[model samples]
Structures are given as C-alpha cells and as structure tokens.
Target: MKKYLIPLLAISLIWGCKKEVKKADESKEIMTTEDEGWTYLFDGKSFDGWHTYLQDTISSQWQIEDGVMFYKPDPDKNQGMNNLITDKTYKNYELSLDWKISVDGNSGVFYGVLEDKKFVVPYMTAPEIQIRDYTNIPDFTDKQQMSGAIFGIVGIEKDVANKAGEWNHFLIRIDHDKNQGSVILNDQEVAKFPVNGEAWEALVENSKFKDWEGFGITQNGHIGLQDHAHGVWFRNIKIKEL
Candidate 1:
C-alpha cells in the first residue's frame, strides 16, 4: 500500500508541472500577438495623436473623461465643424475602435481624409463609415445610410449594431494590395468593397461622391471622426499596419 501511494503522488506532481507549463505558453502567445505591429491611436489619457480637421488644435467639445474620448455638445456655443482627425497618415492598415452614440444620435468614421484647404470638410476627400443609432431613428429604413455602411457607397451585409448608448466594436481593414476594404462590426463582417481601380471607380460613380474630385482618389490619408452635433463616445482606438 505504501509503494502504490508513493507512485500516485509522483504522478500528480508531474501532471501539475505540465499544466503550469501549458498556461505559461498560452500567455506568451497572447502577448506576442497583441504586440505584433499593433499601435494604440488613443492612449486613454489625452488626445495626443488627434486634432480637428483643418485646424491645428483639438476642439473643446471633444473631451477625454475616464478612458473615453467623447463629444460634449454645448447648447450655448455655436459649434461649427468640429471634426477630429489623426495627425499621421495611413495607407493600408487595420483599424480597431469602440463607439457608442446617444439616443437618435449620428456620427461617422472617415479614412483617406485629405486636409487640403480645397476640401472644406473631411467627407469631401474621405470615405465615411456611417455610424448611427438606427434602432432609435424612427422610420429610417435606408440600410445604405445606416451604421457600418460605407456612407452611400456600399451598404452593410447585416445590421448587428447594439442599441443606443451601448458599446459596439469595429474592425476596419483597408488593404490596397488586395484592393479590398472591409468592415467588421461587433465581430461580424458587415461590408466589403474595392479600395481602388475600376471597381472602386464604379462604386464612387454610383454614389454621392461621384463629383468630389479627391474622394477616395488617394489611398493614403488621415483618419477622421465626425462631429455631427450628436453625443458620441469612442475608445480603444488602435491600428495595425498590414
């Protein structure tokens, strides 16, 4: 009986060691993937890498509270074009962020945003990912204009957005190498379209951006956030260059 007990104890010790080793390996793998070419656009402390479109500074309406970057509208002040954009430019990359809108609020995320004086607004040059609380918008049946749509250029494949005031995640990938741009909303692939060439041209031609000369013409540009006079919150903004 003593001999059998000794063998059983030894076996238990070996099994424990093996389990510990497996856990350590899994933790290492997770760290490696998170650090692999990914960068945080917002550090949750301040708006260090962002500024207003066409302006050199950030607007007072855009506030950083706790860890969220949000728009706080001033009823007394006349807010004119307070759109925020990144300081640096990105050509082909994967962008990830979380956003929440007020009840019946509207906003958007833009890419390929040109800051030239000729373009008065970011939408003039960039393509927008429409963001809105469609569930709260009465009688708004236009899926092309809803959240996760490519703003009138392309509609989303599904509507999986959370209700107003609830958080929704977006993983947007723009790959010029593959000539494809995609939007993954709440881990669901909602939209996909061409970023350049004839297919892109056709998409633009059929959309409202057909007359805008700089719209989606350049694959490299700044990313922008719309200030559509509605309350919106953003956080966990990061990017990975592909």
Candidate 2:
C-alpha cells in the first residue's frame, strides 16, 4: 500500500509542476509590454498619422481637445463627405477605439480603404463598422443598418450602442491571411464574416456594395473614420498587427 501511494504521489507532483509552468508561460504571453506591436493612431494630443481621405493633410474641422479626436462641421466649409483616413495602410491587424456620437449623429470606422480620389468615398472601397446614435437615428430600418453592423454585408444582433454623448467601445479584428474578421461593440461580440472567397463574394453580390467600385476588393488599405456630416468624438484609437 505504501509503495503504490508513492507512485501516485509522484505522478501528482509532476502534473502539478507542469500546470504551474504552463500558467506562467501564458501569463507572460498576455502581459502588456512596451512595444507589444501596438501603434497609437490617436496619441491624445495630435493626429500625427491620419489625414483626410484622398487628401494630403488633416482638415481644420477635425480637432483634438481634451485628448479626444473630434469632428465639428465647419458649416461654411463642408467638404464633400470624405472620411479621415490613415496615411499609412495596414494589412492584418486588430484595432480598438472608443467613440461618442451626438444625438441624431452618424459616423463609421472603415478598413480596407483604397485611397484613390476616383472612388469618391471611403465606403466605395471598404467595409464600415457603423458608429451611430441608435436612439435618434431613423435610418436604421434593418439590423444590417444598425450600429456595429458590417455596413450592409451583415447585421449585428446585439444593440449595445450607448446613448449619444456616452462612450462606446469597439474592437475590430481583421486577418487577411485567415480570411476572417469580427466586430465587437461595447464588449459584446456582434458580427463575424469571411473576408474573401465565395462566401464573401456571395454576400457582396447580395448586398448594396455589389457594384460599388473597389468595394472589398483589396485585403490591405487605410483605416477610415467617416464624418457623415455629424458631430462625433473618438479617442484611445490603437492597433496591433496580427
């Protein structure tokens, strides 16, 4: 009985040691470290890496105040509804941002924006994660048109958007290599879709973007923030390459 107990005790010890080591390794992997491949798109004080879509510079309407990136329409100098786009392009990445829209306001965060002026609008070349005031916007006729929708390709089931003037968190993970992506709004995972292949193409063909020039045609492009002629604030914008 003693000899049998010794062997069982030894096995238990070995198993316990292996589990402790694995937990430590996982802890290190998730620990936040400096230069963890995260790049700040909005560093609180400056819009250093961003510009107006199809333009070489940031517009005066876009401003930074209290560390928030905001858009206040010039009213007198409204440009043709172009989004604020990243000067640098990304291929596969995980993006996170926070936004608060004004009552009746509407905006969007788009990826895969092909920046040729010929397209005229960012939506013509990319997919948008809708930023909208869900309480006041009357245009949301379907789930696909609601906040956090993949902008027509698919509609999100969770309506977790906060009230206007309240902050809403968003995380968008895009992986071209895996041909998959997802959108999370206010900590609720709302949508997932194929980025490429027949599944992706079928959705495009059935949606409003079927004939739009360059829409979802590229795997890599600029990130975009739509003005939508509405007042909105964005901050804590960061991205990590996958």
Candidate 3:
C-alpha cells in the first residue's frame, strides 16, 4: 500500500509540472505577438477598409492623395457635414496617426464610436480628440479646442501643433481596465483622463453627452475622423491593442 501511495504522488507531481510548462509556453506565445507591435489601420493608398460613418460608401469629399487620406472641404459646404470611419472595431489600444489641418480648419480623431444612424449622424455616439489650428482657427476660444484636447472634456497645455500646413503626430492610449485614457502630441504627453468612471461621469453629467447611452463605453468600436468642412490629411494611422 505504501509503495503504491508513493507512486501515485510522484505521478501527480509530474502531471502538475507538465501543466505548468504548457502554460508558460502559451504565455510566451502571447507575449511574442504583443511584441510584434501595431497594425496599420490605413493602407495609405486606398479606403478599401473604411467607410463613411454609418454609411456603406466613402463620401465624395474624402479622398486618398499623395499617400494620405485627406478630407477635401468644399468652399460651398457647411460645417459638420462629413465623417469617415474604419471598418473594424477596437477596444483598448494605442492609436497613432499623422495629421495636418488647413488654415482655420477644424477636425478630430474619435474612438469608441458605435455606428448608429438613428440621429442625423454617428458622431453623437463618440467622444472626440479635437484637432484644430489653435493659433489660426478663429472659432475656438479655449484651450480645450486645441490640437490635443479631449475636446470639451479636457484641455492640453502645450501648443504642439506644427504650422497650419505641416504634419503633426498624435498618439492616443486608451486603457479600459484602468478606465483611463491619454493623449500625446509630437512625443509629448498632453492630456489624460479617466473614462466611464468618476472623472468621466462628472464631465458627462452636465455636457451634451449626458443622455447618450454608448458614449465613452470603450469596449469595441470604430475609429473615426471628423470632416468639419476643411482640408485635413491623415496618414500612417495604426493601432496596437492593450
């Protein structure tokens, strides 16, 4: 009986070691994939995987030229008219892009955007990171309307934008577990905030987003670009899931 007991304990220990080794191998695989880095959201030559917000086709005003997806605003057009969005959905991620706005142009990068056309447009479901010519754009009077702001929710301190026609880089990191997010401009940290939590709750409590159900939920949704009747170019748009 004693000999049989010893053998049984040895077998159990061996099985446990095997299971541990298998788990370690699986973890290594996951880490390797993560280290592979960001996937391109835009292919630089086509809008093959993108569409108009809540629409099946890209708008006539949006085009890809000189290897950049650009919003060509018509002088005859009105404000807040066009929007472009990615075909895929993303949750927690680090999104990076290069953007340049025309003189007095206003645009934005939006995420956590659920595609719903129940209203006149899909922007009602998402929060925006404002992109504007801070020194040249006359409409915005506050820092929150500047290039790196979380548009109306939080303001960024630095004026990190390149001149009106030069390209500027932006990085946005969204962490769903911590219920927080941040924005960086030209490799500098600009703004940070909590999402769907107390800080966000306070901001939404009295803002226009108060009654919106899907606003700032941040589970999985499209990436979007605002077309505020001005020429804006974007390139090298990429993301890595956190």
Candidate number of the best TM-score? 1
**Model-by-model lDDT, in order?**
0.91, 0.87, 0.83
- In the range 133-235, model 2's lDDT, one tens digit per residue, is 7575455577887788988888988688888999999999989999988999988999999888788999999998898878898788999999788889999
Candidate 1 accuracy as lDDT: 0.91
Off by over 4 Å in 3: 1-35, 76-79, 137-141
lDDT of 3 by residue, 1-242 (tens): 99999999999999999999999999999978865788888888888878887678777788888779998876776556578888898888899999999887789999888887664555677789988875554455587878898887788887677878899999999877878789999899999987677778898776767887777765678888998888899998889888
* Candidate 2 residue pairs in backbone clash: none
Candidate 1 regions with alpha-carbon error over 4 angstroms: 1-29
Candidate topping lDDT: 1
Q: C-alpha displacement of 185 in model 1, angstroms? A: 0.3
Which scores higher on TM-score, 2 or 3? 2
| Candidate 2: regions farther than 4 A off | 1-35, 137-141
Expressed as tens digits, the lDDT of each residue in 93-186 for candidate 1 is 9999999999888899998888999988898899999998866557887888888999999997678899999999999999888898999999
How large is the C-alpha RMSD of every model relative to the true structure? 3.8, 8.9, 11.7
For candidate 1, the clash count comes to 0
